[model samples]
Target: MSIDTLARTSRAKRKISARRWLVPYVFLSPAGLLFVVFLAIPIIYAIYLSFRGMHVSGGGPFGVREETWVGFDNYIRTFTDAEFFAGFGRLAIYGVIAVPVTLGLALLFALLLDLPRVRAARFSRIAIFVPYAVPGVIASLLWGFLYLPSTSPLNWILNQLGFADLEVLTGGALFPAVANIAIWSGVGFNMIIIYTSLRGIPNELHEAARIDGASEWQIAWRIKIPLVAPALVLTGLFSLIGTLQLYGEPTTLRPMTNEISQTWVPLMKITRDAFARDDLSLAAASSVVLAIGTLVVSVVLLRMTQKKAFGDGS
Candidate 1:
């Protein structure tokens, strides 16, 4: 071939190679733009707001309030606030009730469904998961009516049977009442994840266990559970995050009961600070703290479970 022709061919090949590289990025551009606009920008704005506060210049009611750089003042205020910490305490109580019960029920349901000769598995799965399909606010409302003494069928049944009324939405019962909303909505989703993981597990292991004189229960407890540890870890982490971010259910149910205070959970407190109290800086700081705390917790959990669940050596 002529030298000019060879050069033209080489340039053509280079252009095609560049086009191939650009194709993936072109496809990814819309998603990347969305992430930047919806997620990254909002996070950056919140962090910026965290470091700023409204300063009152000159004094008294006549003084002008202006946005000013406040350094760590917001964070300091967030840390020192009794209500903020109290919200965490409430979250701890809620988590203690919700997380274990949700995960346990999910795992139990997944296991039962995985068992041989379990009739109506599809219908059962749909029934369990339907609650999760209900929006959190709607679920809270549905449960709220059932909790109210006047409207509750359970209370009516007790009255009919000559039993005392149960105060579910008050005092100590309030915690479980709120937690139950979470448990009901969460279990089906977690169960689906666990069941999917269980299905992925090879049947040969179960066969091998059976051949070695192991019962179905032993095979599940030994081989299946261990193999699906990673799924459990994933579901547990999700539950932990959901527990920390508990807001919708409690907030929805709050109007129905006085037991849930305005600052019932950290997120609710943040919302109040931002919107109700108009303390944007304080709310931003609280949000940043929560986001950091959640990140740290997720990291710690994954690190601790990596070896056992994921079989990671590092």
Candidate 2:
């Protein structure tokens, strides 16, 4: 080849190589930086803190404090503690009630919204999704007052029906009460996600099913539900994670009722350990356990669902 042609081809290859490397880095930089700063740094710090115990020598403000490495003592203590185990049990029960109910309702709503005969679908969809915009803390506070016997409309209705006292925030009712708030707040978002995925599905499939004499129910069950399984899995995972990390609703309702203890949930227990009791090592250990538990549950659920839905290991 001529020198001029060779030089031109060399320059072209250099430009292509530079673009190939630079484009991905440019696109990934924001997320990479965020993951490092927000997630990686805090997790590393917590892991470091979990391994060390604080020592306070002598008394008063002049006491010297030191962080001494204690190996797996914090983790051992956390696993042995009855309070931590009880908290995990409670959260598991809560998740059992909340995640399925929320995801089921979301799927139902999404399917209903996708139907052609549903009137005012636009308005209804927007109205249902409005709760997602409300902060969890604020939602809990509002529902907390509404759950009170003296202030709740349900209590008034019960009083008129010859029962003078009805408390939704009490024992037995407390689980459903907490689950209701989570469902109400989360259902809208999940519904929207499922509905968006449903909309992406081709109308031809439904039309062909209809032509084949399939009923709406059959088509929904056999076609739409199967098609949107991935979205359902996504929503279920999100709900499961949120349920495992539940804190706001129970914590907010604590002042109003005696039902919720200091360690009502795992996160609440961690907060109490870290701040209320000033046991940072225990708190860090509990936090690590919580993170690991969440990770395990998410992975297990995803794998199970993927196997069932796609019939292949994910």
Candidate 3:
């Protein structure tokens, strides 16, 4: 080939290589910018703030508010806080109660919907998912009213039947009362997730099982449930996260009962420390602790369930 032609070909190849390298990043720029601006920056700032303690001047409105670097003191205080540990204890119990019940109901509903010739399957799916569309604050308010002994229709029915009023808002019942709202809102959504996964399973699998004289229960137990185990694990992880961060329902119901303290849950305590006490440093430390704890728990759980869900462990 001529030198001129060879040089032109080399230039064309370099241009193509340059475009190939540039195209993906050009397309990803907007999303990458948004992730940095929204998520990454905030998390980094929170971690920075967690190491600093706040100090305000006594000099009125124009007073100087200094943020002093305190190393790990904020973290130490957060770890030593009685209210913080108490909140976690309550959350652990809440997780125990909420996660199983929510996942169980979601799985049950998913299986029922997966059944052949199930009546109003579409309608049932929509109805179950309706509560998921409702806002958490609104759901808390609605269930809070239902839990009140005086305003509750359940209480009225019990009274008419010569049964005493059920105090659902206090003592041992309080955990499940709050959990019920979480379950009511979450179960349908998880069901939709599991149900969608179930629908994705091939019809040939079911047909083969049936031909082998497997009953409907056997098919679901041995075939359907096993295939849908990943969905169950995912939903369980979400439920665990939600239970640990339990705040809304208890805060909403606080006005009606004396049982709930200002530090009812870890998130609630963090919120109070940040806004009410104007201690952002303490709040930041608590938030970091909560985030780390959640990450550890979720990683442990995923590892535990990995073999069953994915058929291999990493």
Candidate 4:
């Protein structure tokens, strides 16, 4: 082609390439705007608030209160607060029970559903997942009724059977009671993830194992479990993060039982500080600490699992 013709063609190609690059950004603009407004701005504002404290400005101790920079004072208070550390201790206990049990049940259900001849698999899946569909507050209320001695049918049944009524919502039973709610709601979601991963595994692998005189259980133990390791890691990470941020269920159940204090968990404590106590600076500091702890835990967990799950040596 002549130089003039080639120059015209190059200009048209450049325009097409430019338009292609612009299209994705155009489509992404709404989400980008939302992230900045809802997440990024709020985070930046919280970090700023963390360093600010309210103090009396002028005349006396009861004088006008003003927001002032306090450096790491809020953080110091957060670290030193017994109640704050107590909340984490409670979380550790709760998580130890909830996380493993939830994931274990999920893995079990997923495996059962993945069997070659699972009867009513669709119905079973829905039955399991329906709890997760229920709102946390609503589910807490439903369980609260069952837990209350006055309203519990289990208590009525026990009375009929000459056994004492159980105190499900109090003392030692409280942790397991709270954990049951989490497990009931959480298992289905994690199950779905594992089931999806199981489905992605090639049928040829299972058939080949069977032909080699391997039992179904052996195939699952040796092949299926290894293949779905990534999904397990993902669900584990999500569960750990959720455990760290436990709030709604415990908060909702707090009114029903005195065992759950106002600052039952870390999130509840943060909420109380921010709203109930009118200590936004302390709340912000606590929130920043929790967020950082969550990030570090998540990164460490992912790093530890990646070599086994994703086969990433790096």
lDDT of each: 0.94, 0.92, 0.93, 0.95
Q: Mind giving the per-residue lDDT tens digits that candidate 4 earns over 80-117?
A: 99999999999999999999999999999999999999
Question: How well is each residue in 21-97 modelled by candidate 2, as lDDT tens digits?
Answer: 89999999999999999999999999999999988888998999888999999999999999988998998888889
Q: Candidate 3 or 4, higher lDDT? A: 4
Question: What TM-score does candidate 3 get on C-alpha atoms?
Answer: 0.92
| Position 188, candidate 4: lDDT | 93
- Per-residue lDDT of model 3, residues 1-314, tens digit only: 99999999999999999999999999999999999999999999999999999777678898888878999999999989999999998888888888999999999999999999899999999999999999999999999889999999999999999999999989999988888999999999999999999999999999999999999899999999999989888998898888888888889988988888889899999999999999999999999999999999999999999998988877
Single out the weakest 10-residue window by summed lDDT for candidate 3: 54-63
Quick one: best lDDT, which candidate? 4
lDDT of 2: 0.92
**Clashing residue pairs, backbone N/CA/C < 3 A, model 2:** none
The whole-model C-alpha lDDT of candidate 3 against the native structure comes to: 0.93
TM-score of each: 0.97, 0.94, 0.92, 0.97
> Can you tell me which runs of candidate 2 are displaced by over 4 Å?
1-5, 58-63, 160-162
TM-score of 1: 0.97
